[model samples]
Target chain A: MRSVQIPISDETIRSLEVGEPVALSGVMITGRDAAHKWMVDTFIKKTRQPEGDDQQVYAALKPILAGGVIYHCGPVVAGLDTKDYRFVAAGPTTSSREEPYQGDVMRHFNVKGVIGKGGMGPKTLAACQEAPGAYLHAIGGAASLIAQSVKRVLGVHKLDFGVPEAMWVIEVQDFPVVVTMDAHGRSQHAVIEAQSKSALEKLLAA
Target chain B: MQDLTEPILELVRLTSTDLPADVEQALRQAVEREAPGSAARGALETILKNVALSRANSTPICQDTGTPLFYVRHPAGWSTRSLRAQIESAVAQATAHAYLRPNSVDSLSGKNSGNNLGGHYFPTIHFEEVEGEALVIELMLKGGGCENVGAQYSLPHSQLGAGRDLAGVRKVVLDAVHQAQGQGCAPGILGVAIGGDRGSSYYASKEALLRKLDEPNPDESLAALEARLTQEANQLGIGPMGFGGETTVLDAKITHLNRLPASYFVSVSYMCWAYRRRKMVWKDGQVSYS
Candidate 1:
């Protein structure tokens, strides 16, 4: 197992190998479907004009993503009325859904990694290579356990997107994941998909 | 009629936080099947520990608590309107209590309801009047990852030489598992409905998932098909989260409906490893849960 703190250096991220276990700590931000779209449209694509605290949200996230990781999650939180937010269940959402925006987001922000479940497509793998980043695969549906690693909910952005779609900044310790795709262009997900496809064909023939 | 909001709230809480004994047991067995220090075993171990933590702390097992699916079998003369109101009430309360996330979102407006109530169809409720004086409600919290990977196949699919028969059903099901990979949340239980129209096909497929994990279809042919499909799917080696290990599917439950002569459809609904589902019964002024 390897230990990775937030704002991970490119050298450290590049050294990480696919199929290796990792424990991520320090501060990171959560972004899911809506957050990704909003980021691309308002900032990267410049298709949608910045409005309603969009600039402020970006300002908050800019430094965090410069070398830090973005987690694909929409966590269940408590104390919204009081604004003392606490993440109750915060597991990784399926990353493939964000494939359209993930690569662009990484390039725009110089992000070091994307943490999520399942995996992403070739575009994301290419982005990882360009930015010296990686794709860390968290266990899908292991929410309560994963939340235990979250020591604090620093803040949140995009409340109108609902609890699951909102981007949350949090402090974590020892968040577990497997390095499915690495900067060196190796991808465990691609390997597994190919192997499974071959196995399926053989079974059908039998 | 007695108000059922409280019992339903409890049902939502338990279902969200705890895994059914059968599902948990299968996960335990799956863990042992993986090689030591393998990602598959590590994933299952984390899942097992998460269930315990969620149960003890009464937190949601998954951040996406998912849409609530309710199957209601009540006696005649009971008001479905009132029952629905009560269910919605309990669902909102659960959200406030953090047992459920505010999952409902507007399709066009790009807005969230901020409660689980997006519309009438948001928390899907299927009601049937049975010949009994009791009321029974079954709830399943099907997560979005598995739901997104669900699939339906038309009969006489020429690619695999599949035709309108049980053989075709097996082919499509295996195809779905391979396509789903880890995205369907492996060690998944497949709920398959064959022979219904497109809409009912999908509906029945999801409804079939409410069955106990190990329960088999009553029909001899269907039971045998279920067994064969389960084994073959695991053979594809898409273990937990597609990490690749000994187990891919924990169980498969199959059910069929009469189809029009022109149509033969097979719908497969994938349930994630969390497998959050539970039942509540109201009988003779007494309430019990299982």
Candidate 2:
């Protein structure tokens, strides 16, 4: 198992291999379907056309996102109204749901890592290789266990997207995940899916 | 109705925090089956540890506290309206207490109710009029991850070469499991319905999940099919969290519905290892939970 800190460098990400378990520390940003779409459509695609507040939004995120990890999660938070928010249960949501927007989000934000489960498609694998990022697979249902790694709730963005879909910036320590898709262009998910499909065929034949 | 609130709240809390014994046993066996130091074993170990921590700390088993489904069996004169109101109230309390995450969202506006209530059919309750004087309620927390992977198939599928027979049902069911891969959190359970229209078939499939994990269908044929499918699904190497190991499916419960001659539908509902379900019985003005 590899223990790495956040704001991870591209060289560190590139050196990670598929199936290597990792303990990620430092700060990361949470974003799921709504946040991903908002990032891609509002800030990324309109990068050149700085209209309205798009440029400002892009500028605000640039520093935080450069070489940072985007976690696909919708954490159950406590004390939202009292200005004190505690993570009740925070686990990785299915990554494939954001497959279309992830590649673009990674490249546009210079994101060095994507933390999620269920993995992504060929496009994401290729994007990780090109962007030199990695896809970290967190245990899907281990919500409370995962929340233990979150040391602090930094800030939040896009509250209009609702609680689960909102972007929560959090500080974590020893956050456990597996490198399912690394910057080296290998994906354990793709390999497992292919092997499982062949096994299904054999079962049907029998 | 006021008296019913506490039991319902307790039911919600227990369902959210405690891993049912049947499910825990199945997971323990799966852990033993996997090779030492394997990824699948590691994932299952983490899940078991999570279960223990959640139970001890009284936290939600999964972040998605899911759509709370209530199956109620009441005496003829009992009011379902009052029961629904009480259940909703209990759900809100559970949310405030952090036993349940606020899950209901406005589909049109994307606004969370913040109390796990208010959306249409949220905390869905199904009532059945029975002869018994006791009120029995079963609650299941169906997470979004497993719910998204559920599939319904009409027989005579050309792609699968499935006909309107038992073989066809087997083919499509296995196909759904394969498609789910690790997305639904494998080492999961399958609740299958064979027959009924599109809507009822899906309903029956989820209802099938209410059965005990260790129990078998009373019908001999369905019971055998359940065993066979469970075995074959594990053989697919889709193991726990799709890490690859000896156990992919922990249990499969099958139920059949009478359908019109024109329709033959097979619906499958997948439940993750965190299968949160519990029962509460109200008898003689006293409530007891299991």
Candidate 3:
């Protein structure tokens, strides 16, 4: 296992290898399908304008996005009625759902890591190589254990998108993940899929 | 006739925090089956520990408390309208108390109700007028990850070489399991429906999941098929969390439905191991839970 802090540098991300376990710390932003679409649309809109750029649309998120990690999660938050938010359970959602938007989102935001489970596809893998980022696979269904790593809820964005789909800014310590796709262009998901398919055929033959 | 709100709330709490005994036992056996210190074993260990902590702390077993599915059997002359209203109230209370994650969302508007209420079919309730005099409710918290991997096949599948026979059913069902790999949180359970229209097939597939993990299907042939599928899925080497090991699927359940000649649909509902479900029964003015 390796220890990695957030706001990860491209060099650091590039050094990570696929299938290695990691303990992540520092601040990470959370988003799912809705937030990914919102971020990508904002990026496209900003780039199209004469005076606009990626930085302008993402200005507010720049501090958190620059060389940082984006976790694909829909945490169960508490204290909504009191206006004080707490994560009761935090775990990775399936990452394939964001495959279409994640590559561009990483490029636009200069994000160095994407934390999720159920690994993504070719587009995401290419994005990781292009952006020099890594896709970290958190253990699926290990919600309470993962919640233990989240130290605090810093803030939130796009709450109207729904609590599960909203972008939540949080601080974490020793959050566990496996590097399923790394900056060097290797992906455990692709490998596993191929191997499992062959195994299925063999089972059928028997 | 009694106020069922509190009892329903308790049911939600129990379902969210506790792994039913049968599921825990299945997981325990899987742990022993895997090679010691392997990644699959380690993942299962963490999950087992998480289950214990969630129960002790009364926190949700998984972050995605999932879409709450309610199956209710009521005596004649009872009002489903009032029961639904009470269920909605209990679900909201469960959210506020953190027993459930707020999951009700408007699909088009992209707005969360925040209280896990309001949206159409949000806390899905299916009501039946049974011959029994008791009011029985079963709630299953089916999470998003596993739900995403569910598949439906129109039989005579050219791609998979599946025909409109039991062999085709096995082929398609296994294909679904293989495609799921580790994405649906492997060491999962499969609930399969062999026939029905598309929608009804999907519904029956999910309904099949309501059966207990250890319970055998009454149909002898179907029971044997279930056992065989479970064994074959595990042999795929897509162990716990897809990390590779002895167990990919803990159980595979099958239900047969009559279908039209033109449409032979097979639906598969994959469920993660969190498997949060419980039942509550009210009889003779007294309430008890399972």
Candidate 4:
């Protein structure tokens, strides 16, 4: 198996090949359904006032504090400021939950990398191609131990949404993630499902 | 008969934020067993690790602190004043102590129930009358990601294409799981409830999930179906986290109702890797661990 560390960058993300297992290391932001909605409303859609100016947003259902990786996690977080704590349960909601808002967030935030348990839907791929960004699929249900690897939780924002669904800003190093969908419009999720179905048909015939 | 309001509430509190002793032990052992894939195995290890962190630091195991779902089977013919309130109070108490992240959000107003209370969507409790004098409660922290994958379908009675047979039901379930893909977090447990009306099917599915992983299905046909589904689903190669490989489903469970010629409804619920659920059986005057 080929393993390589890719730095978080807009152009690098645009060139990723399909089905390439990637280990991501770089600054990544955490945003989920609530946060995604917030970003769109506040920024692009302008339904809600802008929280901040242009930046890269990760479609993370949870966030981990480790060396320098952005986990696609939206953890159930409690507390505020430095005292924040995350539990290792199902904080990572479905990545599809943010399908409608991902493309907008990428454009508005200038996000280079996105980490989540599941890859995003079609709109996201279109956006990724137009922008400098990629969707990395991390193994789902690895929340608890993954939290332990979080070297340091840089800071947390948006406590108003409650911990389980809050938008967290965390930093990590050498975080494990696979490049499922890259900026060049390649998607591993679609490829694998097709392959798996065909393989199952063969097994059934055999 | 004693008023179980306070005690039941206490049990709810303890189970929600704290991993009961048996659950803790069981989880620790599961990690040691070490599921196949590095990621699946790693996920279980993290669960055990989180239990340690939670127990030591008194942090809630997961932030979802989900809707405190309780399955309580108490003595038959026993009735009390305001059972729901008592349970709610217990959830509130446990939520406070567990340091559970406030997850209950007011649907109409879209505001967080700051104390993890007040929301209609949380602390979902189901009650049943059983042959015992005491109350047995199974508390599950049902996170939204996993909960979203739950499916309830009404299949018209027939054979072949006429009705929902094994193949038809299998197709629905397979599609349900496949549609869920990585969203519900695979390598998960699927709770299937068949042969009931809409509401009963839903309840039956949830009840089926309470069965222990190793316990054999009571009905031979359903049990056989359960085993078959488990094998078939894993064969889908959904694997842990839906990445690929074997070990897609940890277990599959089925519970059914003896139905007439009416429509058959099948409901499926998905439990993600961190299946945080515990049981407490009441005994004597003192509340003890399960």
Instruction: Name model 4 segments beyond 4 Å from true.
Output: A1-7, A11-28, A47-72, A78-91, A151-156, A199-206, B1-61, B76-83, B119-121, B156-162
Model 4 chain A poorest 10 in a row by lDDT: A61-70
Q: Write the per-residue lDDT of candidate 1 for residues A13-101, one digit (tens) a residue.
A: 99999999999999999999999999999999999999989999999999999999999998989999999999899999999999999
* Regions of candidate 2 where Cα sits further than 4 Å from its true position: A47-58
Write one digit per residue (lDDT tens) for candidate 3, span B68-90. 99999999988899999999999
**Which rank order by DockQ, best down to worst?**
1, 2, 3, 4
TM-scores, each model vs. reference: 0.99, 0.97, 0.95, 0.81
Give the lDDT of residue A68 in candidate 4.
Answer: 23
Give the per-residue lDDT of model 2 (tens digit) for B1-290: 33598889999999999999999999999999999988888999999999999899888889988999999999888889899989999999999888898889988877888888875599899999999778899999999999999999999898888899989899999999999999998889999999999999999999999899877799999999999999999888988888777898999999999999999999999999889999999988888888
The worst-scoring run of ten residues by lDDT in candidate 3 chain B lies at B111-120
Sort candidate 3 into its docking category: medium
Clashing pairs in 1: none
The C-alpha stretches of model 1 lying farther than 4 A from their native spots are none
Q: lDDT (0-100) at residue A95 of candidate 2?
A: 92
* TM-score (C-alpha) between model 4 and the true structure: 0.81
The DockQ for candidate 3, computed on C-alphas, is 0.72
Q: Write the per-residue lDDT of candidate 2 for residues A79-177, one digit (tens) a residue.
A: 877858888899889999999999998898899999988889999999999998999999988998999999999887766677788888899999999
lDDT of 4 by residue, B1-290 (tens): 66666676556545545665544454455445444545446555545666666666555555555667878777766553356667766666555554455667777767777566784446676778888566677777776778887887667423223246766676566656766665676667788887877778877787787777778987898788888887787777766566565656667888878655767777888877556677777766767644
Better of 2 and 4 by lDDT: 2
Reference-based lDDT, residue B247, model 4:
58
Candidate 4 docking band: acceptable
- Candidate scoring better on lDDT of 1 and 3: 1
DockQ per model, Cα:
0.88, 0.75, 0.72, 0.35
